[model samples]
Target: MIVKFFKNSGGGSANATMNYLLGKENDREGARLLSGDPELTKRLSDSLNFQNRYTVGVLSFEEVNLPDDDKRAIMESFESSLLAGLDKDQYNMTWIEHTDKERLELNFVIANVELTTGKRLQPYFDRVDRPLVENWKQVTNHEYGLTDPHDPDKAQAVKTLNRQNLPKEVQQLKAQI
Candidate 1:
């Protein structure tokens, strides 16, 4: 499974910056962290600042039997990876577990990002429900804001016809007119 989390940039240029950070070039190190590979995490974090306000986790996971020791090892590895990935800033990690008669699930709140103005931002991570290639279709078709381009209320009729679509005499008359 692959999960992505994003924080909303208020709008305009802030949104562009967020988009760039999520791109391949700026997020190469962050992508390494998501791979659950310790060596890559170490190498990538050495050269990049993962603690930036726009930092997002792009996590990938495989299913395994639930074992305490194995879980501990994975968690510890992620903690070390995150620490090395981030810059020198205070951080908080929260873990949430929910159990019902049918199922039990665990969620890790790795970190909460804070803006320069001292406001804590909400994390907006999305779980990719499909394969990466199919997921591209979802992203490509997604509409981010409230506006709709094809809304009837906002549409206007074109006043002029194409010259090729017009009668030949109409074209000559339009030239004279």
Candidate 2:
């Protein structure tokens, strides 16, 4: 799978993050915390109060060109690895999965940050995120007997790439056209 991390944004409240994730940036329905801090029931409202402190991480997946079922499974795998990869208990997240575009993309919003920790989350997001994603890709693909295109040495993927191409009929028809 192809994974791309958009720039992490700050100063936006959790409610706005929710709205944007849902493709409803202004919707009153707001955003919900899928996991973490169940006791913090007012995450959305409370986040609104901490606009400056909240941060967001948007990770998009595409170019793997897997089927719908495989994509959904990978999304789950992606989420788990992300939390484990961060190795921190400092985030409150909401995952928004979108297939409305040309490729299936997932938007992960790390909505809450602890200001007192006095650390910048950006470096972690930049340096650690992709490697964690690659590891998840390697593990998940191996489980299904697939090769990860992003894997180091990519020799196996290169061999498979030639076979996984447009159908012979499509190629012939294109030639005729």
Candidate 3:
């Protein structure tokens, strides 16, 4: 996965950081800082270690203060750099944003390259959010499985089944047989 990193400026959680990285610089100040500093750009790139990877593309958010013209220029530069360095046919691009709320949230955009026509591919989107870590322990330990007796053999059997390479449906078939 091509993981892009963006620092969040708003007082809000990492969600803001992620939103910024995805080119949604609705905030003005963050855009300005990101557009102006080459050092920052290089640092961001280095942090992500984008060199020689199948995942290609610009993975950062514009600082909020960047001028509109500069923001456009930076994006163009990033696009050019990515296109020049990687084969459009084989690789895909993605942007990842990190958020720190009561729950974790992830947003992803995937861009594919057309094989036959060699055109820039469009983006697909997905997102996920779940309660914080502590809540998970409470729910899993206290819920449906609680009243059920702990059977070590059954647990081992389940573990063995999981470790097998077969797909879930095939595993079910095997169990039935």
How do the predictions measure up, each by TM-score? 0.28, 0.48, 0.24
Writing each residue's lDDT as its tens digit, candidate 2 over 1-177 gives: 445554435554455555566645323233333334322412632444443444455434444345757655765666557655454455455555555565545556554453336343342365656677666667776775564565577556333224456447876647644
Flag regions of model 3 displaced more than 4 Å. Answer: 1-63, 85-110, 115-177
Worst 10 residues of 3 by lDDT: 124-133
TM-score (C-alpha, index-matched) for candidate 3? 0.24
- lDDT (Cα, 0-100) at 50 in candidate 2: 49
Give the clashing pairs for model 2: none
Compose the digit string of candidate 1's lDDT tens values, residues 70-176. Answer: 43454454444444444324444333222321232233433334323344433333343235423432332232222233347757665355665565786675775
lDDT tens per residue, model 3, 45-81: 2333222111222322222133445434434444444
Candidate 2 has a TM-score of: 0.48
Q: Is candidate 1 or candidate 3 better by lDDT?
A: 1
Whose lDDT is greatest here? 2
The 10-residue segment of model 2 with minimum total lDDT is 25-34
Superposed by TM-score, candidate 2 places the C-alpha of residue 122 at a distance from the truth, in angstroms, of 7.0
